[model samples]
Target: MNDRGNASARLIAPLATLATVLLSIAGAAPLRAQGGAPPFDVPAWAFPTAPPPRPGTVPVVPDSVTRHTVPNSTRHYTRKQVGNAFDIPDWFPRQHPPMPAPVQYGVRPEGRACGFCHLPDGQGRPENGTLAGLPVEYTVRQLRAMREGTRGSANPAASPNPMIAVARGFSDDEVRIAARYYARLQLTRRNIVREVAQVPTTRVAGLLYALDGTGREPIDGRLLEVPESIERHDLRDPWVRYTTYVPTGSLTRGRRLATQGPAGPTTSCGACHGPQLLGTGDVPPIAGRAPSNILRQLINFRTRARRDSTAASMYPVVDSLTIHDMVALAAYVGSLPPSRTPRK
Candidate 1:
């Protein structure tokens, strides 16, 4: 740890200078905007919305209906069994919902399944997070944070993130069960990140972005990552994947900032996240995560909205970043392949 700190200190000054200049240019708003609206200061893009129906098909409401049929072997199972995230469909089920029936499917009094947003695989969308391979202790701590209001959504519009309420409602046993289940899964890489000057014209739909037109539009220093299969994602199909579109050269810039700080107030991620950035002990892995999710977390740390002993260390680390720097760092981290080693 001493050697790591010394090495990280070497890169801070240059990165800090670059970050200061970038922040001045971008002002204080987040890097993206919705429709023709002014750029908001919050990370509102982290929420997933119910996507629209294909060309002419009727939209399937996520919780109210089952668009796909269950297997023959389990066809006789009750809704309590089928609906539960824990009692998951077994047809090539890559991951299982770890919670009990009520927690997986959700009871009317409490709300939706824990997997409904995070997904059964624990590889959540940009709006949420990848829970796979997280430390059980770290996971439990975060749940406590949300329950205590020490951590939450930074976007005011996304304020009172449902997870806060969900955490508050959970029993200690339930949290432990869920955390252990997720911690046991192996991490896997998903989204493919690319930097481009122009991107498909998109509209802010749901808690994500959707391609809106064939006509190309400049990314304008904004980040847009969307699912390749809108219909499947809306169906809550666990197999769906995504593509992240960022500004050209963002990855290169991000790589520099991540592996070696330009100076200012940051250090190489490897200094603490392990040499591979796959995480060190209680520190969670940042590699191969959704860029949008990474950006949201960095923003949270900067704003001190995610307060905890661990996050307390992150505040100073992110304070010097410009929105552009955040975008670059997120892109670079999300581009790496996830560590596949199962946690002990």
Candidate 2:
């Protein structure tokens, strides 16, 4: 291996063991979950388990006969066209570079189009993490981990995890293509994050929360991530905005936990995620992502569900965090603006 490669390898080994000895000395108390599970337990709000799809929720409509339109969108798509997973919804294709075949259209047969759920812009929704401006190498590694079963949800048995099936279906070349496409896709905007004590009542609407007209209720110390307009979001409008209502004082607590740590300075998130929590080298940036996704990853790391090499390095840092701590960290990090410049 080249000298630089050797240096890089040397650098990585220590990170996996980062703050381990010091953290062991700290010996944090076990945090209890709402259901009396471990500290890393999946919080209901962050990973809001969607109800099972009703048998007749979606009414049958003629594909070509029905026309669908979203706000500010001049283009129209038929019911069949929108339902076709192979044909992604690109509401504003001019805003981004042309997506590679793998991104614009999924690898045939088993693979689903990359843009379908993530959106054509790669901005993604609250259920998944952002893909835009990600390091290609890092994204590739993550995809590989999913394919090999090394990456997974902290709680998987309860809900369907599509990434595993999707990753398994992707050819390595296709993975690279999609990763490169998303990497080159610049971040256009940040999701709206607000810390509130009370939030609008919500209903489970297809793996995401949608505000119910039943009036406001206490946030109850969890993140309430919902789309500004569920109808627009369902239309796969890449420009659709989401409002994540975090617990009161979550941002301040999260910022403190990220910078100062629970006890003292030890492998702070910024150390690997960059000074502004953007990212460093092949490490994925955490800022401006969905707080739900961030919390899910933190739970995955702490629970040892995502066992990829880089995630192993997150053990010490994530282990120190409780659900509340992770919530604060995710809220603060998610509220920040993403890095505008590309990193090599």
Candidate 3:
């Protein structure tokens, strides 16, 4: 009986040892298949990896940093430095190379790369004026004004002139190109219902006429009442003049006031801006622009907020505008269709 029990014990111990060895081999099989590397293999050389770059230690500069020295050796001129070293380019003769082709904005070809901000559509935001379907000639003239500092906001105190800065970057041909692109786009028709409620009481010229239940009212003497429901529609006004949203009648009235002096003022608009209010070589076109924008500018002139060398020329003209006249003039200018330079 003792010998049988001992034999059973020895057999059980050997079987247990065999099972343990099998289990270990099964576990080791995956490691062998995985090339015997640790789960996260640390390279033998990198094992004690320099204690993770002592906090905030200056990083080792790569050798590529030395490439910047090549430009220093060549001494290439920066824009300002070049201008300072060389004479100013000639204004009339071929002093500079022809400008590069303009960047296209959608179907429209922006002569001056209008896509930088206005995007493919001329529906620019409040920061910049919309240029879709505007008169090409007017757009060019305004760009000229901005570049030459002849036409701009009446406010002089505003430190940086955004329009002026933009204009300064464009050449004459570039302005023409951009203007032409915008002039061809379909104009957006806005259902403008004049809002009488928003109109300042001080600015109201006459008794309100018809008040639409929608809050717009027409005032006497052609003054557009505010609160007009200006729904942004996709249609363009066929009667608009070059690069401008103003109507012909409004432009005619503005012309009369600008040139012949309506009511009280003496000189004509042509005396400063050319005939047809098309603008002189340097002056900007006033025939077609946003009425609201124009009104704001005229007010700025009245308030002495804006200033320019040309302000003296407009002082007498603007000084004569009664609140009604100002409104009428703005409306007139805004109503004219945009004009364009005929393609040669």
Whichever of 1 and 3 has more lDDT, that candidate is 1
Superposition TM-score, candidate 1 onto the true structure: 0.74
The regions of model 3 sitting more than 4 angstroms off are 1-256, 262-266, 340-344
Off by over 4 Å in 1: 1-66, 69-91, 94-103, 106-108, 262-266, 340-344
lDDT string, candidate 1, 1-344, tens digits: 01112112221222234333443343322212212222224333343344345798985444544335333222233333444544343333534544554335543444456676776668776677888888888988998887765675455344456676677767667777777878877667778998899888766556776666566867766677878776555545555678898999999999888888634325778877877788888889889888888988887666555766677667556766777888899999999888856332
RMSD of 2: 11.5
Q: lDDT of each model, Cα atoms only?
A: 0.64, 0.71, 0.39
What ordering of candidates by TM-score runs from best to worst?
2, 1, 3
**RMSD per model, one decimal:** 11.2, 11.5, 33.0
Highest-lDDT candidate: 2
Q: How do the predictions measure up, each by TM-score?
A: 0.74, 0.83, 0.38
The residue pairs found clashing in candidate 2 are none
Question: Model 3 lDDT vs. the true structure?
Answer: 0.39
lDDT at 321, model 1: 78
Using TM-score as the measure, name the better of candidate 1 and candidate 3.
1
Please give, for residues 1-344, the per-residue lDDT of candidate 3 as tens digits. 01112112221211224433443343211101111211221111101011235788997553422221111133332333222211211121131123223423211221234543443345332224466656677677666755554454322222134455556666778677766666565434321323132322212111111122343222223333222211111011112212222222454556566556653544665565555554565555554444555565665454333344444555556655665566667665555543444211
